[model samples]
Each structure stands twice: as C-alpha cells, then as structure tokens.
Target chain A: MIHWPVPEPEIPAGTHPALAAVARAAVAAFRDARGRFDRTQLAEKVDMGADGTPTTRLDQLVDTAVAETVDAHRVNLISEEIGVIDNGSAVTLVVDPVDGTSNAVAGVPFSAFAGVVAVDGEAVESLTTWLDTGRSWHAKAGETLPYRTTGRRELDGAAVSLLRPHPKSEDAWLRVSRRAGRVRVLSSSCLEAALVAEGSLDAFADPGSDTHRIMDIAAAAVLLPAAGGALIDAYGRPVEIDPDLSRRWSGIAAATPDLAEELAEEINRPSS
Target chain B: MIHWPVPEPEIPAGTHPALAAVARAAVAAFRDARGRFDRTQLAEKVDMGADGTPTTRLDQLVDTAVAETVDAHRVNLISEEIGVIDNGSAVTLVVDPVDGTSNAVAGVPFSAFAGVVAVDGEAVESLTTWLDTGRSWHAKAGETLPYRTTGRRELDGAAVSLLRPHPKSEDAWLRVSRRAGRVRVLSSSCLEAALVAEGSLDAFADPGSDTHRIMDIAAAAVLLPAAGGALIDAYGRPVEIDPDLSRRWSGIAAATPDLAEELAEEINRPSS
Candidate 1:
C-alpha cells in the first residue's frame, strides 16, 4: 500500500436543518420515482421537456410536488427546469428537481441533490443534500464532519468520474484517464462530482462544452468548497456562482486544493 | 420512448453449482479482504504482487484461504498470483483471485470474478460466478437458461457501457456511445460485461489492450451468452476460452447478436 499523508478537513457549520430536510425530501422523491420508472410496466408515462430532455409526467409532477412542498417553508427556489422563484428573502434555495434527467429516465440509481445556498447579494454559504440511496453528504462553510476517504492522495489515484469523454480533446482525455487511478463515467455528472465533495471520490471533471448549468453544479459548488475542495472552470480558474441560474460552465472539482491544482495543471497541459 | 416491436428471445440456462461455489467463495474472500484492506490502519500491511499488481496481506491470506476452502471440494485451482494447483482429478478450476487489481487497491468498487469451465481435457461443460456486490450469474453449456436482460430487447434505445474510449478502434466508441440512449464507463470490464449478461446494461466494450485475460471474461463468457449476450475479442472475433488458465485476451460483450455485428462493422470502418 502506497501510503500518503492527508489532512482530514472539517465540514462547515452553516448547513441548516432546513437545507438537510429539503435534501432528504428531494432524495426520497427521486428514489421513489426511480423505482417506479424502472418497472417494465411503467416506462412510458412521462413527457418530453422543451430542451429535448426526458421529463416524464412524473418528472413534472415531482418538480411541482417538490416546489409546492418546499414553498410551504417559504424558501426561494432556484431550479433546473424552472428558473428562480424569489420570495423577497436573503437566503436562496437552489434545486435540481431531478439532476440526472437522462439517467433517471433510464433507471440508473444515482442521486437527487437539493442545496440551499445562503447568499446576501454576492457572498455565499453552506450546502446539504441527500442521494437516492438514503445516504446524505453535507458540509457547512467551516465545520469538520463529512466525507473523507483513506487512500493515496494523488489526483491520479482519484476516480475522476465524467458524464462523457471529451470529444474535441482526445489528448486531454488520455492524460486525465491515465492519471486517474480509475476512470468511471457514471451517467449522473451532478452526483458524480458531488462524490468528490463528500470524499467518496477524490475529484470530478466535466470539461464538456459550457452547457452544464449552475443548477447542475450549484449544490455541488456549495457542498464541495465547504468541504475543503474547490470547483474550477475548464481554464482552471475559480467558478463564480453568480445569482444567474442559467449560467453554464465546464470545470473540475477536487477534494483538496493540491489535487485541484495538480489535475488542472495536467489536464491543462498543451496537447502534444 | 422509441419502443421497437420485438419478441423477447428464449432465455438460456446457466446453472452450474460447483463453479458457482468456487466463484462465490473467492469473491467473498476478496470482498472481505478488500473491505478490511480499505480500513487497515497500517499502510504496509498490504502486499504488492510481482505482477506490479496489489495484493494485501489480506489478499494473499484471502486467496490462500479461498483456495484451501475450494480444496475441500476437491477441485483443481488456477489463480492469478499462484499457478495451477492440481487436486488429483482431470477437472481444473480457472480463477482470477481479483480481476481488477488496480481498482481494488484504489478502493474502487468493481467485481472480483471466478469461472470454472469444467472440461475433460478439451471438452467444455459449464461455468458460473459472483459479481462485485455478490450477485451470482452463471450458465452451463447446452443449457437454455443464461443470465439475460430485458433492456437489450430494444436495440435502438438500449444503453451500452464501455470500459474506456475505443483504443485505436475505428468509430466503434463514437458509434456506440452516441447511438446508445445512455453510455457509461464503470472501469470494471468484468462486472460491466457481467451486468450486460444480467441485463442491467444492454451492452459493454473494453477496447483496451489484451490485458483482459481468459480468466477475466471466463465467468462473463458463461454469464453473458447464457443471458442472451455475445462476447468477442477487440477485433470482434470469437473469443475461444481454453481450459488452461495461463491465457488472457481482450474483448467486448453485447446484449444482442445484432449489436455485436454493428459494433464490429463500425470498428472496422475505414475512416474510423
């Protein structure tokens, strides 16, 4: 065993009970929907969305269902399909009713993550969410109680899970894939990247065209950095989580700053 | 939901208790050792094998432990680290103590498979084994029941999982990854191929080098074909499994014969 020294970082304290509650409810909703969706008997009861994404009648129903239930708590909603719903409050709630629409439609068991990012104009804090498996990973802005794994701490030893391989960047794919101790392309990029924040994985890379929205990585943005990990744009720059819900960005997330830097440097290396 | 009209094919039988028994014991030992190895407080407690592969003291202990347990059943053993051990019978047991050694050492969850292709010198009879999570998949020759999947019935919309991007293969990766409704690379070729057999995934491909051995795909050979899938080499040729455990090969497994043909043609495309 090639042992490496790792500093166990702490989870922050801003993870509110309200955020955790919403995250749990979101996960349960997704899990229940997933089981029903996978049953051979009920494969086609859903409808298609405007973006050409699969949105089942169940999906819309679940979206509205989550919206209504969370609205009861009077938290402002920033969602994937639907944009933001402001209730004249400082704390904004961001949600992806179903993050991995494609996978969820196809019966892959991943996660439905919901995050609450308390923002006062430009400053942000905290994220908490649960997955379909009833397992939750959360971290406050500066606390010490969340995901941590024991292993060699090289970004190379990390499982860099991607949604799809880089098409225009074959050389980049080879570099990342070779360095990644193991590469997994789990369909759900949202959950895949969140695993990095939870320390279940060392890093997560998207590096696709800038089509991945903030809603896709918003909860992850809040969750990862709070856990001592960082999410950076494809250019290896920090991703600014503006109030804009539709702002799309391509990037990577690392469990540690050192890993984020290492991966960024390697992935950003000039393709020979 | 792009539903295609098709009748389900006859499911093949893959019931082989003795082979299944050996596989089960080996997988269980590896998994238990793996779990302990993951939590081992000391780093050097693990053993690195001569093949540049990882073997924990737990792995060695488990391999021996599993072999001795199988010895009680009076079957010969052929494993990765240790060469073939005779048991005074014509029967030989082919085993890969751990299929994805790199993945295992890195704590990546993938299957550790075993195959017992009962052969009388040159004639083959049956095979069976367990996957990463301990799910049993197997089949016997001339048996009608092979582990099969329902998803592969819809060829047009079926999901195909690959181990890595096609390596030097023409449009094989592109055609498959884009054509399939969903594509994933879970890193474990054996388990991914096994899942194809079990119908969890519609198809699987590992276009890597010939590092994948007969032992790696032996259990899959029994499981996939019995489950209505086809396994072939990277060149898309038939993968012949010899009774001797010394051989290794590279290949792909598809849920349907049509898919296998499609993949082969695509990979052989001149521009690809």
Candidate 2:
C-alpha cells in the first residue's frame, strides 16, 4: 500500500464566512457521493434542467447534495439543474455541482465541483475542486498575494484549450486550431480556466456561442482576474454573471489582457 | 496519510519473459525519471530525432532509460529518437519513450510510455503505461480476454479524439468535428488509443498526415484489435508496423470495423 496525503481544506481568511461554508459543504458532498455513484445509473435521465440540458441520475445526486448545503445558508442559489432558489439573502451562490458531466459519466477523470459567491452581481470569492484529484483552487477578490498567469503572449508556441466547435463556428475553430501551437479540448471550462490562471495552460477560448452559462464561468471569472489573467466576452468586454440562467456568453480566459484581446480578434476575424 | 493499493506488476503467465521484463523496465524508468524532470529543461531541443520531431531534453532522459533496458535483450529495436538497432534477433521491439511530450512538459497529466514487441511484422505483444497515473494496459496476441471498445456505431453521438489538425486538413478535421457528438485533442495517441480500448472514448482518429510514425501506433495496433476494435489506415487498410521510422499513416481506431470504415469515408469525403 502507498500512503497519499489527504488534502486539508484551507479557507483563506477574509473570505465571506457563508461562502467558505458553502465551499466546504460542496467538497464534502462530492467526495461522499462520488464513491456511491453507479456507472449503470449514469445514462438514466432524471429530468430536464432549466438550462435545457438533460439532468442525469448522477447530476441529480450531486445537485441535491450541494443544493441542500446552500439551502441551509440564507442566500440565493443559482444552479444548472434547479434554475434558481430565491433565499431572500443579500449574496448569491452560483454553483455547478458537477462540471464536465459527460467526462464524469464516462470516467475520463477530468471533471470538477465549482462554486462562486457574488455580491450585487459582482463575484467576490470562488472555489473549484477537481473531483478526481482532491486539489482545489480558491481566490478572494481583493487579496494581495493573488495567483498569477504565465507571461506568454504569442499563439505560435502557446498551449490553448477551446470548446468543441459548433457546426456554425467550424471556420473560426479551424483558424484558431491552425494558429495555436497546441490545442486541447478538456471539456471542463472552470478547471481549464483555473489552469490558465495557474500558468499550466496559456488560454482557453470559447467561440461566440450560447454554450457557457453563469454557473460555468462564475468561479473562473473570480479566479482568473485574481491570478493576473482576464476572462472577457467576445467583444473583449467584461463578463457579468447575473442570477439569470438563460444568459450565455462567448469569451476567452487568457494569461494576460493583451493575449485575450489578440485571441478575440483572431477568432472573430472574417475568413478571406 | 491514506493507504492506496500499489498496482502489482502482473505479466500474463504465458507471455514471453523478455517482453514482460521490458514492460516492467519501461514503467519503472518512467516513474523514476518523471519526478526528477524539470519543466525549465522542456524546451531545450538537444537533437533532431530520427522520427523528424525535435527531441527535447526530457525526451532524451527517458529515452536513454528505456533504450538501456531494451539493449540488454537480444532483440532489434525501433524508436523515435535513435532510429533502429539490430540485435540479430527475430523480435523487433517498437518504443515511444515519451508519447505526448508537450503534455508532459506542460503538466497536462495525459502522457504515456508505450511499447510493442512485433514478430514477423505482426504486433504480438503490447504495453502502454499512463505516466501520470500508475495504471497500465497490456495485451498479448491470441489472448482470450482482450480489451473492448464501446458499441457506439453512429458518429452523431461518438466521442472522438483527433491529433491536432494540420492546416492542409482543416476542412476534413472540421467535418469530423461537426459530425461527432464530441471531439477532443488529447495530443497523446497511445494514451488516447488506450482510452478507446477500454471504452472511455468511442474512437481515436489520426488525420491523414505524416504526423504518426510506427512507434506511435504499434501498441494501439495490438491492443485495439484484441479489444474487439479495429485500427486501420485512413483508406480502411490494415496498418503495418515495420522497423522503419519514416513510414507514416493516416488512421482511425474505432470500436468496430464498420465504424472505422465509416470514419475513413467521412474524413476522406470531398470538402464541398
């Protein structure tokens, strides 16, 4: 037998107590439910989510675990499966109980549990736990010792992750694929964005499509900017995470503001 | 500290002892060198490999470890780095010391140490060790219990992994991407093929370019077939792995022969 260190949850000081509690609850719930998750039950569709995606049995199990945790706290909750729960609290907790659902179901080992706390539509604190590996990335908005992004600026030798292209955006996807030195499709937006923030990946590009929801980008929005990177919409504008589940944005999470702008132009440029 | 079961090295009883020893050496060599590999040395191109790719410093370190092990055996060897060595033996061991070199250097955790022992131009035994996790996949020809591919036939819902598309085949890559339910660029052909063998992924398609050499496909050629899947050339022809580093093939590894043929047609179909 080989001994591996169990990760101790460390909630940074100055984070909202409620937010820290939610994050802890999320990590514990996922760890408990993951062991009991039956692979045979993965394909069973439990319900249609507010986001129009089918909620599998695995999604329901994890969603309920996280929802119950957030419900205990007096805060508004916005999630993929259960559109929104108005708790009549000042802060809103945005959560994707299980990001990369397909990967989880298929045992790809690249999914995550993600959550973010927002105050009056501005993200203040966030946490992302890699479900397969117990490592977590957390950030508070105004912390001095923030995480940092790599100083890589060019695409020629840069490693970038892109969302799988929709049929309409094939040309744009191809152009980006050709230009970037290396391209990957990890299928987890928040985790990939966290990787960009930590300098493992140079950037993550989402083609201008209605693919990403608030729950998907909330944690990343806080983590990236805090890490010296920026996650912006296709027009190089700041992305706002409202309580609405229907709002979708196309954007890039890059190591630098300059790289984000450069990628936005490259992706949005017309093909000659 | 939590106790995790260490994977016991299990070489099938009927397998050739020499091939099994090589597999063990490859795994141990990778695990030892991986910990000491520095990221700063990743970009130092020490030499141009016989396979035409620039051999990075990390590659040389692991390659040397693997080569020394193979040299002790009375068998010919073919590899990406030092070309071929003839030992006046009937067996030819094909090895890719570090598949997915970029991913290893960048901390992507999806690279592998892949090897295959061939007898008279036919892959007789194969091994692929995932360097990130200590899990391994091995197969011997004529074994009753081979690995299996998923039963997915249609492309509409298939999860396919492609080698990053080159500029000339951007249109073909787009066609595959649009038709498949999910498309991933994992960069490691051997690991991706292992995923296909174990049914984690439905298929792994290598675009018809000179991107893949014998060392890259040797293990997949053995394991995929044993698992009730077919790894064929883009023209739906059987791939032949010889002691040549210069031969390249465009291929698709599907869960079934029918699916392989379908993908070949889809990729080779005229781009209108």
Candidate 3:
C-alpha cells in the first residue's frame, strides 16, 4: 500500500468548472487505485493506449474516471489513453489523466493530473495538480499568473529537468545535461513544467526525445506564457492545441524565450 | 514564495521521542526559512560546512534547528553542516537536516529531513520525513517494519533511482541506467532510500561517485534492513554510523542483498 493518502487539490476559485471537476475526479480515482491495488497490480498492463503505449491498471482507472467526468461537463476531451472523446462542444479538455503513470504506480510520488481547456483549437486555461500532495498550479492564457518564472535567459547556469533519455536521443540529452548547472530526471513532464512556471526550475525539456504528445504539453503551452515563461519544440515545430494524438514534440518549457532557444540550440549541437 | 505549507510528519507513535522532537524542529525551521527567504537568499552559501561542502542558507538554518533540538535532548549529533556535536552521550543522532538542499531552496519539493538514532556506533532506529509533503518512513534496526521490500534480486527489469552522474562516474551511471527498466534522478538521497526501503524502487544508488557522507546514508543502514532491504557501499566498504563527516561512500540501497551486489558489480564494471 502507498499508505499516504492523496490530499485534495487546492484549486483556486474561478477555475473552469469542467477543468476543476476533471482534476478532482482524477485525484479521487488515483487515490482509490492506490488504496485497492499493490504496486505490481497497479502497474499491470491492462490495455494498449491510443498513444501507442501500454496503459497500466492505475492509468486505466484514472482515465476512465476522467473520461466520465469530462462527459458530465459536456466537453470534448483529447487525452493520451482515450485518444479523443468528441461531444460536439467547442470546449475541449486536453488532459493527461495520470501524467506520470509509471511514477504513480511505482509509488514514486511525482505523478500529476494535467488538463488544458481549449476552445476553437486554442488553449485558454490549464491546471496541473501534483497528485500525491494535491499542490496545484493553475493559469489562464493571456492573464498574469500570481506565480512567475525565474526569467532566466541562458542555459549556462540553469537548473534543467528532463525526461529520461531514449537511445536515439542520448547524444542530445548528454549535450544539454553537460552544459546545465544542474540536471534532474524527475520523470514527470507536467509536474516539471509546473516547477518551471513557479520559478522552481529554470526549464524542463525532452532534449530532442520527441516524446510529448499533445496532452503531455498542451497545458504547459498555456501555463508557461502566463507565468512569463516560454514553451517551444526543440525542432522548431509549433506547439498547438491539437486533437490529434499522433503528433508529438520535443517540448521545452523554460523561464524565458532566450533560454528555451538556447536549450534547443544546445540539444541540437553536435557531439565533439 | 513557495506558498504551499509544509504539513506535520505522520511519525509512528513508538518512535524515539528525541528523534520526533528533532524532526519537528527541522520541519519548523525549514518552514520558517521558506517563509523568510527568496530562492536566491535561501540558496546563498552562508558558511562552509564541516563536511567540506558549502552550506546553503537553508541548510544552515535547518542544521542549526536540528542541533539545538539535539542539545535539548542531551544527545550527541553527527550531521552534514554542523558536523559532530559531542555532548558525551552514548546516543548520537545522525542527520541530514535538508537532504536535498538545492531542491529545497529552489522550491523543487524533493527535500527531506533524515535522521538515525545511533548507540555507541550502530544505527538503531531511523526516520525520514519528506519535508514538502510530511510523509515519513520510520524503522528500528532489528525489528520488523510494517513496510517491506519488493524482494527483487536482480538489476535487469528493475526500477532504479540514482544520483545525477558526475563526470568521473558517468560511465558507471550509464551502465546501470541502460540495464534497468526505469531510471530516475529525483535529487534527494534520503527520500530515494526511503522509497527503496518501502519497495517503491528496486534500488537507489550513487553508481560510483562516492558522494555520500555518513549522514547521507546512515538512516538507510537501519531502515533498509528493518524493511527487508539491504544497504551497502558499492566499493565494498562497510557502511557504519560514524562521526567522521569526511568519510564518503557510494551508497547502494536495494530490495535485497543480491540486487545490491548486482548494482555494485554493474557500477564498478569498465565501460565497453
């Protein structure tokens, strides 16, 4: 048993009702899964997800609860496991119901529920809740967030968090890691991006892994800029609120545009 | 501000009262520091630690609090920043007041307060509190703990948490990382070790950087064994409760002796 109970997210007032409901549902489902399942059982692969990854039992439970919650709100949802739930509503919720499913099932305690509210294919608001502790980061597009970025402009001495390196991206991963003042692989993109928005981390990047599907980063695209940070793809592709689960990006969330570009440059640099 | 409040630790009732008081003091001081200082101010190098590492302001603050608490308890203390406080008692508290000082000061939320009650040179009891969330793991040396290890015996197909690779230890780090099914660098030693003790991770290791001072790993010496796990030095040095802050170990905490040995072998292997 994970023993520790998941706390309720301290969601702020005025959050979109649908987004808040989905976050609560995700958290409740996650807590229930932890309570009922052992680590191996929670991690057991129950089905193949739409994003070409195996869905663990924990992910299945949380994603199902989120899908139902999104339905109750009469909103469309673009999420990793379910792919797309179209309700013909212009308001769509892009969510990673359990963003760090591996961490969640393993009891590593870095998982999150991340969601973005998009209308007319444009993200207008986002919420990321660290499931274990219920601490949350909420932001609206074009609105000044109470939290702020470090406003750091360079990678020379930046604190960077990254996804674990895949074989194909090993060179790029090492390149950026070698240049950064500090490097961490927390294995949770949404939580790391929340860290960036709150000025805890200078940046969080995929380091050319191209591992981020739309739901993995749609929230960061809205939240980063609201906190005076930048979100860009390392390969110069535009990040957008798209319903296609097939598209991917090497998403980079940074304290500033200059630092994001610098990180992209470093990731693309040839090894000596 | 790292606006989220730190909660009180959920320590078990039978824990040594001195350990409980000291944990409370560390948490209180850490919360106070977070309230009073900005990131830059908290991260400022306030003094040279007895362990030869520069003591961050946050470390100094927590260490002082821990020290004062130990004095009030009339116990000796062996710690990172303050070194040995020999009060002529047979009982000594080995502590890392802020295990991940960088994470704490930067608001990354991976820091912890880890301590061991040592009697005459052996760790008899331990407690590790995740300061950000107040989740704690407590154990006594020869007693059975409510938590248990995964009982994994091999590194292949295992989940491993590791310290960030140093330039000198990069080869060793990659060797284990490639073989493990998962890799993480959460940047908090005691929390990682606690995870190992509770079976969340198959192993937590330093690879071969030899970076752990006695206080960095003393808690695991008691907690791991109590939880049916193993704690060993990668280089085969006996991990003892020592007052010598200068002694370093490439600490390996794993689910079982076999996995610890396998991790040690992999870490010491020459790169191909």
Against the unseen true structure, what C-alpha lDDT does each candidate score?
0.57, 0.76, 0.92
For model 2, how does the per-residue alpha-carbon lDDT over A6-65 read when each residue is reduced to its tens digit? 234455566666666766665565555445554446647989997888998777877777
The best candidate by TM-score is 3
Clashes of 3: 0
Q: Best lDDT goes to which candidate?
A: 3
True contacts kept of 2: 0.71
Per-candidate iRMS values, in order, are: 2.8, 1.1, 0.7
Collision count for each candidate, in order = 26, 1, 0
Task: State the lDDT of candidate 2 residue by residue for B94-211, as single tens digits.
Answer: 8888889888777666778788888866789888877665567888776634446786777777889998888767777878878888888888999898888887788998866647
Candidate 3 per-residue C-alpha lDDT over A48-166 given as tens digits, one digit per residue, 9 for 90 to 100: 99888999999999999999999999999988888899999999999999998889988899999999999989899999999988888899988999889999998987899999878
CA RMSD of all predictions: 8.2, 4.2, 1.1
List native contact recovery per candidate, as a fraction of 1.
0.37, 0.71, 0.76
Residue range A127-215, candidate 1, lDDT tens digits: 43424333345555555544553322477556677657545655566677777766777766566666666545677776444556666
Tell me the TM-score of each prediction against the true structure: 0.78, 0.89, 0.98
Query: What tens digits encode model 1's per-residue C-alpha lDDT throughout B24-81?
Result: 5665565555445443321233565433455655457546765785588787766665
Candidate 2 Cα misplacement greater than 4 A, ranges: A1-40, A73-75, A88-91, A119-121, A144-147, B1-37, B144-147
**Isolated chain B TM-score per model:** 0.73, 0.90, 0.98
Question: Candidate 3 clashing pairs?
Answer: none
What's model 2's overall lDDT? 0.76
